[model samples]
Target: MPQSHPFARVSILCKTYDPESGFNESHAEVIELHDDQPEAVDAVLKYIYTFEYDNIVRTGKDKTRPQFHLRVYRVAHKYQIPKLQHKACTGLDRACRKITLQTSGSKNGSSSEELFELIKLITEHKQYDHSFNTTSIYLVQRYLSPLMRLKTFNE
Candidate 1:
């Protein structure tokens, strides 16, 4: 880790672990992400090292899946990487906007219930977080009208 890297400022990595003390010897050098998805972790690492991460979440037709970016945002927030968090948030917002625009918020888009799932996902991860709450608001207030109008809008 270089001196200028934002990851260098993360508290877990900044700990002065003593080589001789061997504290938590089994995993002293590892930063476990038990709750994070592998792709999100990969994206965070890629951003940490290279500062670019658009390709990891793209599906067919250049349409980025919002769930992937949401995971990236969660991991970035957990690791205190504000830049990556913001970037992922922007990606998610754009993805939602793109989907809604492409389907004109009707017919084809109503089947894509991931907008509601995204809100549920954020709530599961962090109920008290401003970022998560704001994202939920954006999903519900801004982009959920069409889906909400549908009769199958359960959960």
Candidate 2:
């Protein structure tokens, strides 16, 4: 791996690679993460190893599916994986588009619960100002704007 790689850049990974710590001596090949969601971790690993990920567009009844890309974006940001971050952004954009399409023709647009979840995800990414700002703007422009207009018209 290159010295500039995200794995090398992350302090925790750097510590694990330290020869003096004896961590690499005993488990040189294994890196164990205890407190992360398996799906998010898998997405990061997939991007790191393969430079790509499948199923960026999830299709199912799972209410939490829309947040998956956001989770990936958060993980990538935490790990300093720029490429993965960009990919996650693309995935997130796609997810937002999908959500917009799915809910567009409905009387009130998306369910309150679903919108709440998306809002929560957006809030979580607020520290990542660039991504958060762009995403929030996109959501407002694409989804909330039309919904608001509909409500205004109804009123």
Candidate 3:
């Protein structure tokens, strides 16, 4: 039997342009990433890197074809939820440790630790992405004030 396909947990659809024809086009590819663990740091780059659009177009393969794009969307649609689950698991581990330490001892049972955990989890709903800005919101707001707005009236 044929070997099962190696799957990608994250994907990007690429639309490139043909300078000569002044036309834009689409294609897709599977991205293998290098990282410490599942969904950590978002190792998969964009999908445009893998295809040979110019070469294929020049060779007339695309000119005679109405559907030159590959069937990568199906794979992307399949694995997207799993990739998100992986990212959530990774972020939760970090946030949970912080919450645990921040709440080491609490007589009232409701503490800063609990608040922080709630905030971390609620904030995590914003996709828990692995971008530089995602990791360093303070740096972005401090250095590039115009790039962001204060989420609350306090600051």
What local distance difference test score does each model get? 0.67, 0.64, 0.31
For candidate 3, report its TM-score. Answer: 0.24
* Candidate 3: stretches off by over 4 Å: 1-12, 16-81, 101-155
Per-residue CA lDDT of model 3 for 21-129, tens digit only, reads 4434322243443322221222222222332223322344222221111112212223453343333333333333333212356553334333433344334443433
Worst 10 residues of 1 by lDDT: 54-63
Reference-based TM-score of each model:
0.64, 0.64, 0.24
Q: Write the per-residue lDDT of candidate 2 for residues 1-155, one digit (tens) a residue.
A: 74466555656666756777786544557666665666788778766766655543342344235578777777787778877777777767666666643354766346644664576678678777476667767766666644465543234
Candidate 3 positional error at 77, Å = 11
Return whichever of 1 and 3 wins on TM-score. 1
For model 1, what is the error of residue 88's alpha carbon versus the real structure, in angstroms, after optimal superposition? 1.1
RMSD of each: 5.1, 6.0, 17.9
Global CA lDDT computed for model 1: 0.67
